[model samples]
Target chain A: MKRSERLVDMTKYLMERPHTLISLPFFAQRYDAAKSSISEDLAILKHTLATNQDGILETVAGAAGGVRYIPYIGKGHAEEYLGDLASRIEDPNRILPGGFVYLSDVLSNSQDLQWIGRLIATRYAYSDIDVVMTVETKGISLAQSVARYLNVPFVTARKRSKVTEGATVSVNYISSSLDRVAKMELPTRALKKNSNVLVVDDFMKGGGTLTGMEELAREFDSTVAGICVLCEADFDKEKLVEDYLSLVKISKIDTQKRIILAEPGNFLTETDFSQL
Target chain B: MKRSERLVDMTKYLMERPHTLISLPFFAQRYDAAKSSISEDLAILKHTLATNQDGILETVAGAAGGVRYIPYIGKGHAEEYLGDLASRIEDPNRILPGGFVYLSDVLSNSQDLQWIGRLIATRYAYSDIDVVMTVETKGISLAQSVARYLNVPFVTARKRSKVTEGATVSVNYISSSLDRVAKMELPTRALKKNSNVLVVDDFMKGGGTLTGMEELAREFDSTVAGICVLCEADFDKEKLVEDYLSLVKISKIDTQKRIILAEPGNFLTETDFSQL
Candidate 1:
């Protein structure tokens, strides 16, 4: 293959397997090119990605050295996307009963998922996340997207018992949004022991569901590496969890008046964007 | 940018925005290159993708011409993956109580979702599907994966209503797996009217859930583009729906005897491989 041809395929290959190491010799052999030529192709890829501010290609030097693609986004891109996302959430039609907002369209969009996945994956690019975990229903898509970019597995915690999952460990947490005690469960075989799990959700009212996930992680002997949500109801009652990241913050929602107020969450100020 | 750099970036850009048209002038302007140079670069990408049998770069020739990256997989690749997937499903350890199979690992694995998504997308690459639809819980990830590949939105039907979704339209269907009448709902604005939807699920026994989704699609005056499932139990009672595609067929499962049988389903014979 020509150098141009090899470069195209290499970029696609590396992007598909983010955080996966691919050695120079492997690329050289696959493209039938010299090692020095493969190195040049990678140099071009790394430069292009850095210029785009969307990804990073890290090269490790050693006998076991290889290049790993880290899915990331520039601070400017993050601000723009989150700003637009917040504006979209501010639409009056989104206000629902009980101060809830209808944001399913954003969550179900392919383009939105790609952007949100890259942003979240960038936040924990170096956190050594063993798996992305979320509860069933709305959060599953978020977990899947982040897990895809992070190149890991995702496990969904279920609220109700199902026959398909063999055995599960259940935990009870206060559902602040519903103002009741709710139970969540995870399959016994879903997660491994002592694994670092990233907990994500579509929405967080008082963060009661996120706490439940943290407790469930403890039952499996897994560590809660981080917690993030797409939207946080900041105007609600006191929060149940303090250390968490949110991409969008909904400050107010008047169901009777069809009003909603939102803005970008603390994820911007919290993320370290020096890599860009 | 140089030709080599442009090829790499162009490939990544097109792959990211599958099924979306990109005019030549846009690429020429973005890369600060002549139209001829941009065309040559896309040619190299199209040829390389065709050689790999993984994707197709479709070029449109007209005043509003552009390129579209169609996610496709070769017939050989499909056969190998589905065969391996079927064999993996044959493990007796996956048999849960009441003839249920524990395949959450496959459903949640990023690599598996990628392959499954590509395979299903290849089958409906030309089906003109406007949206991918599935019920809540297990099928959400599959629907998201396929939707990502197809570059379309996905709408998930819920078994129960949630506050965040507001009003919903629901339908009742017989849950053949459990032999009970169960209700499923979708938010009022979840799907647009008269859209073409492809219904997907993680598993199908009597396909009661799929039927419910089909009914929900009809309630919105939408068309059922197709129905696909990751796995279907062939030994189960008579199927409730026809004209569906399944990747794997589980013929039998004897939990006490520790035996299970699996094989590739009709998707291979049904798909046209001439595009490769």
Candidate 2:
């Protein structure tokens, strides 16, 4: 293949498999090009990605080494996306009954999920997240997107037990939204022992669900690498979890007045984008 | 930017936004290059994608000319992937108490979902689908994956209504597994009226859930563009829905004997790859 054709295919291949290593010899064999030429093609890919601040092509040295694409968005891009997302969240029509904000529209959007997933994956690019975990229904999309960028599997925890899952391990936690104790469970074979879990969700009211996921990770003898949510209800002052990050923070929601106040959360400040 | 850098960026950009048209002038402005140069770069991308039979770079001519990246996998790739997937599903250890095969592992796998998504999107690349819909729980991931590739929004039909969703439109269908009448609902604002909906799910015994989704789509005054499931239970011998495709068909499962059988379904034979 010619250099131009190789570059196009190489970019598509690397982008599809983020955080995966591709050795120089393998690329050379695939393209029928010399190792030196493959290296030069990768240099162009690496430089273009860095110039765009959308990804990173890390080159590992030695025989077992290769190039790995990391979905890393720069600070400026992150700030701009989050700012626009927050503004979109400020729409008064989104305020629902009992102070709940209707965010299913944003959650269902593929473009929004792509940006959100890349942002979250960028935060834990080097955190060694073995698997991404989320609760049923709302959190599934968020977890799936993040897992896609991280190139890892994602498991969803369900509230009700179903016969299809075979054996499962259950956990009980306070459901602050319903003001009751709620039970959730995961399939026994869904997650492996001692795996590093990244817990994600669509919304956090009092963070009761986040705590439940943390407890479930403990039951599997796994470590909670991080906790993230797409939206956090900051008006609910009493939070059940402390160590968590949110993309957008809802500071106030007046259902009667039909007003909502939102802003980019602490995720931007908590992340270090300088590692690249 | 140089031609090499432009090719890299253009490939990444078009891949990210699949099924969306991008004009030559837009690329020209983004890369600060001439329209002719951008056309040449796209030609390289189009040729590479066609040679690989993985994607289609559709060109729309006249005054509103542009390029669209359709995530289309050829018959050969589809056959190879579904064959491997079926073989994996043949593991006897996957059989559960009631003859239900454990598929959470495959469903949670990012790599598998990526392939599955591309395959399904390839089938519906030109179907003019407005949105993807699926029943909640297991189908959420499948629906989300297809939605990502099609670059459209996806909505989940919940078995039970949640407070987060204000109002819902529900339908009743017979749950063939439990042999009881069951209800499923979708939020009123989740889907738009007159949409061309594609219903997808993880498993289909009698396709009761898929029927409910189709009925729900009808309630929204939408058309059912397609119906697809990751796995369908062929041994059941009876189905509530007929117009659907399955990636893998489970022919039999003997719990006592610890044996199971699976194969690729009608999806391969039903699709026309020559459309490209």
Candidate 3:
């Protein structure tokens, strides 16, 4: 193939398999080009991605070395997206009966999921996250998206038991919203022992649900690499957990006046963006 | 930017937003280049994607002309992937209790999900699907993957209610696996009435779950564009629904003997590859 053709295919190929290494010889063989030419094509891809600031192409040296694309958004890009997302969350119409904000639309949106997933993945890019764990229903999609970029398995912790999953490990945590304790479980085979897990969820009020996931991670003898949520209800009376990241922080919600106050969360502060 | 750089950025931009139209003048202005130059760049992208049989760069000519990146996998690609997937599913270790096959690993693999989603999306690429629906738990990830490529919202029908979702519309169906009636619900605001929905699930036995999703979509005044599943147990005496596509079909399973049989599903025969 011609150099131009190789560049096009190489760009698509690298983008599709982020954080995956592709050796020079493999690209040369695939494109039927010289190793030197393949190297030059990769240089162009690396330079293009660097210029965009939305990704990074890390080059590993030596025989077993290759390029790995890292999905990353520049600090400026992260700030702008989070700002816009926070403003969107400020819509009072989203406030539910129990002080919970409806986020189904945002959670289901492909574009929003892509950005959220990329941001979360960027934060834990080098954390050795073997699996992405989240509770049932709401957090499933969030965990799936982050797992996609990280190229890891995502295990959902269910609130109820089903025969489909044979064996499980269960745990209980205070459901602050309901003012009662609730149980969550994960299939025994879903996660392996000693794996590094990153817990994620859609919302965090008192963070009871997240704590349950943390406990479940411990059940499998796994370590909690990090915890992140799309939204955090900062108006909550008290929090059950600390040292977690929230992408969008809801500072206040006025039920009677139908007012909501929100801003970018402390996620950025906790994330090391310098890796990009 | 140079024409080469423009093509690279344009491909990534269009791929990110599938099923959406962009006018030629928008790109022409974005690149500060002539409309003709922009047209040439799109042609390159179109030809590259076409040659790969992985995507379709649709050109909308005339007054409101632009391109669309249609996520598609050719028959050959689909066949190869399903064949490989079937062989992998044949592993005895995957055989769970009650003749169920464990598929969390495949469902959680991003590369596998991408191929499966693209293949399924290819069949329904032009089906006018407004939304994708699936039951809660395992089906959520598959729904999200397909929805992401189709650029549509996915709604999950839950087996149990949660306080997070304010109100819901529910339906009842016979759970053939359990030989009992079960109820499933979707949030009232999750889907719109009269929309076209594509129902998907990870596994199908009697397809009772899919029927429930179909009924739920009807309650929302939506039409079932189609139904598809990642795996369907062929040995499961009777099927409750028809006209559904299965990516892989498991013909038999013996837990005691540690034997299982699997093959490419009906998806290969049902999909048209000429679009490539």
Candidate 4:
């Protein structure tokens, strides 16, 4: 193939498989080009991605080395996106009964998920995460999106067991929203032992669900690489867990007055974009 | 930017926003290149995608001219993937109590979702779908995957209402798996009226869940563009719904004998790849 054609295919290929290595010889064989020419094509791809500040093409040296695409969003892009997202969350229409904010619209948006997924993946690009974990229903989309960018499988823990999942491991945690103890479980075979897991969710209130996930990870002898939520209710005085991140923080919500206040969360400060 | 760099960026940009039209001038301005140069770059992208039979760069001409990236998979690729997927489903270890097949592993796989999403997107690339809808729990990931490729938002219909969703519109259907009447609901504001919705799910026995989703779509005054499931239990004698597509068909599962049988469904024969 010609250089131009190769560049287009190469970009698509690398973007689809983020955090995956592609050796130079493999590219040369696929394109029927010389190794030096393949290197040149990769250089153009690397430079183009850098110029756009959307991704990074890391080159590993030596015989077993190759180029790996990292879905790294620039700090400016992150700030702008989060700012817009926070403002969107500020709309009073989002305030629901009992101080709950309706975020189904934003959570369902593909474009929003793409940006959020890339932002979270960028933060853990080098975290060597083995898998992504989230609870059922609302958290599934967030987990899937982050897993896509990280190029890893995601496991969803369910509140109830189904026959389709076979045997499972269950955990109980306080449901702050309902002020009751809630039970959740995961398929026994869904996650492997000693795996590094990244826990994600759509919303966080008392962080009880996150604590439950941490406990579940312990049952499997796994490590919690990180915990992140798309939104956090900052006004909730009590929390069951610490050492977590949130993309947007909801500081206040007046149910009677229909008022809401939101801003970008600690994710902006906690993530080191400079690592790219 | 040079044509080589432009090609890489253009490919990435178009792939990111599938089914959305981008005008020639938009790319020209983004890359600081001439209109003619941008056209040449799009042509190269179109050719490369076509040669690979993975995507379609559709050109719309006239005063409002632009290009759209359709995530279309060739028949060969579809056959290969579904064949392999069916073979994987044939493992006796996947069989659980009551003849239920364990598919959480496959469903949680990111690479598998990518292929499944692209395949489903290919089938509905030109179906003018306004939104993708599925029930809560397992189907959320499938819905999100197809929604991402279709460039549309996906709404999950919950089996039980939650305070976070606010007002909900519900429907009652007979759950064939449990042989009992069941109810499912979607938030009132989650779906728009008169939308063309594509219904998807992880598995189908009597397709009761899919029927409920169709009814829920009807409640919103939306039309059902199509219905698809990742797997269908063909051994089940009766079905509540028809006019649907399945990627894999499970013919039999003998728990005592430790045997299972599976094969690709009607999707391969039903989808018209010639449109690309």
Interface RMSD of each: 0.7, 0.7, 1.4, 0.8
Error of 1 at A184 (Å): 0.6
DockQ of 1: 0.91
On residues B194-234, what C-alpha lDDT tens digit does candidate 3 reach at each position?
Answer: 99999999999999998999899889898999999999999
Native-to-model Cα distance after best TM-score fit, residue B89 in candidate 2, in Å? 0.4
RMSD of 4: 0.9
Q: Ten-residue segment with the worst summed lDDT in candidate 1 chain B?
A: B4-13
Off by over 4 Å in 1: none
Tally clashing residue pairs in candidate 2: 0
After superposition, candidate 3 runs with Cα above 4 Å error = none
lDDT of 2 by residue, B1-276 (tens): 999999999999999999999998999999999998888888999999999989999999977989999999999999999999999999998999987889998888889999999999999999999999998888888999999999999999999989888899999998888889999999999999999999999999988888899899999999999999999999995899988999999999998989999999989899988865
lDDT scores of the candidates, listed in order: 0.93, 0.93, 0.88, 0.93
Tell how far residue A161 is off in model 2, in angstroms: 0.5
- Per residue, candidate 3 scores C-alpha lDDT tens digits across A157-226 of 9888877777889999998877899999998999999999999999998999988998999889999999
Q: Candidates' TM-scores?
A: 0.99, 0.99, 0.97, 0.99
Q: Please give the lDDT score at residue B189 for candidate 4.
A: 92
Q: What is the lDDT of candidate 2?
A: 0.93
